[model samples]
Target: MAVPDPRGGPAPAARAGRPRIAIVGPTHPYKGGIAQHTTELAHRLARRGHDVWIESWSAQYPARLYPGQQRVDAPEMEPFPATGYPLSWWRPDGWVRLGRRLRRRADAVVVVVVTPIQAPAYLGILAGLGRAGRRAAGPAVLALCHNVLPHERRRLDEPLIRAVLRRAGAVLVHTDAEATRAAALTAAPVRVAAMAPHLWTAPSRRVHAADAPAAPDRAGEPAGQATGEATSALGGPRRRLLFFGLVRPYKGLDVLLRALAAGPPDVALTVAGEFWGGQEATQALVAELGLADRVELRPGYVDAADVPALFAAADALVLPYRAGTASQNVDLAHLHGLPVVATSVGTLPAAVSDGVDGLLVPPGDPAALAAALRRLYEPGVLTALAAKVRPPDTAGGWERYLDTLLEAIEGQRRVDHR
Candidate 1:
């Protein structure tokens, strides 16, 4: 059963008849937040009696262009279909045709915007859809922005960013910080919504047995002492630390390994997921730090089916990303009620309440990360953190998020009419 979102409430009626919605983004074989968000949003909207369709990519990225494996997660779930819509960089007309078909069918279009790397594909699809349906007056395009700017810093990104934002009728950002940046990017207004609750695998609400053997105490409390509430797998006696997802330089896995090496010898680290450019460098660094024994490297792209076992085995999740706009890893950790240890980069601090839900350290600071690890390593810390950590509110109550979009649409409609 899907868990109820903590922040979910009643939503206002969505037009008279059920509204038709088209969600366009990287889905299925492609993993990560972009894919997950697209899937969850479709699922949510479908449940609400909306005629929903997902225009996922047929060809997302070439092997050379990808940092890790071909796809992020395995195609275990039915949602992970082999192919649906093919994206050809050379054939913009073919893509535009497909987009027009979707636009004709959909009452509204929700485009999931990512980095510049995907700008060409998304921008083309949006254009196609807009041209497809002659909407004298209807729902405008809604761009759900994960990041207003690009990572790795590119001179070309600003122009592309400006173009996409200017093209959209309205925009939705998960955080206020992103909203502020989006405001500056385009004349189209940006609205802020709480991060979607089911961005990753849904949370498990099954309460753990109190006084269960080896049950760890709450954070800021003693070991073997129950906090009266059920503890997550992380709060169990054997603490597991997960560095789940594809490995990237900005993700800072090397710093996490070094922190484990320099800190307590008892704490263990699981370096799961496929590696990118820095894998060799990271492996060498692990050996140099003498963490070969303490660190378990499960290299290669991990399948989504395996995530439960991987996360269940761990005590806490570590996201030492040196630079990031926002991440679903932190949200995934919260879904399991597993405490997180992340650096103060982008919107990380907003998700993790230092000393309340999880610890926050400076990005790229191994020492501070080591210290945070030690804090979590202390038995029962994660249980306490879990009690206080609130999962994001995204469910039947998506209207709150939609309100932000509607406000922009209404405002823009006024302007367009004027």
Candidate 2:
């Protein structure tokens, strides 16, 4: 027998002993890592035997809040089967209605908290669920924080984030540092679960063997398969050291640029992805550094189909984050068989394995980053690091993350009842 979808679409058949889950966040038509993460989470949960649905947003943010392009011409991942866009920034009534609907439909709710701007809408949802709704009577709420707070803080960030987290029965953070931050704001249980691999490609996308002759990038550029500036035994720099993803202030692309100028002269860089702000400043920096000839800037949303080539054409992925919680970038690079050179902040040290898989430098320190870049170009260093690069254990990581999430839901519900 087919269970009726609350929104009038066909729902999965109700199964014995399986929970019905509602994941509230961005999805396809929405771009970037968070959107992909949310969609993949729903798919993984359903694959693991739960009945899942994505309660997505028709209008995620007001133009004033997120000025950049939000939707994409093409999707980067497999879209979830059951999704509804009943929530919108302009509709407070929809928020409350969706909340009450979720109470009737889902066994639990996972609200993907990407920013504090989402707090007001989330509060409205919880309000419709009766503010302090009892878990026995309604679905338990878990605030799955991609960032407990944005790396760049705002004036109302604390109070807004506090409102949502405290109201939530449990909070899930991606790192211990984020848990510490979340604990300061909420009395609810805060659990640390590392992000799973969503951007992971098929096994075929793995880097060709080190000894394999220089492979041509899908775009037809030779992979060079080389390391840095100087012509080594293998030849000269084929891939520019890469700085991919959103260019936000906290991400430290400026620091990376300064490092690039000071590091090996022959080493070039390709900076890709949309800039949250500061495109002019970045352009000016490139001009100021005299790196015009050495840098290639492609500032826009990169499609999912183009990701492998970005990784393919890079000697290493450079993540010079001044601060962070966790990111799928390091794992994404490893899956492509590309090593990383990143800052030692947040969960990066744990993920990058300094001197093993990737090099770690101090956050916000241009000199340190420059030195790491220079070191990366040293003869044979890049190859040695690349050899250690391994694909993230996608299944194991998701299973562990799911286990933590489910346990948090149960544990928080028990606490709420008490």
lDDT of 2: 0.79
Q: lDDT tens digits, residues 1-418, model 2?
A: 2323647444454477556778889998888889888988887777777888888899999999998999986566667778889989999999999888887776778999988988889988887665654333477789999988878888999999998988888899888888999999988889988887777332234421111223232222233444343223224444477889899999999999999888888777888899998999999999999988778898997766677777776788999999887888887788677779999898899999889878999999989999998888787788778877777777788889999998988785676567
Candidate No. with top TM-score: 2
Indicate which candidate wins on lDDT.
Answer: 2
Error of 2 at 416 (Å): 5.1
lDDT of each: 0.65, 0.79
Root-mean-square deviation of Cα positions for candidate 1 versus the true structure, in angstroms: 7.6
Candidate 2: segments with Cα more than 4 A from true spot: 1-14, 132-137, 200-239, 415-418
Query: How much does candidate 1 score in TM-score?
Result: 0.78
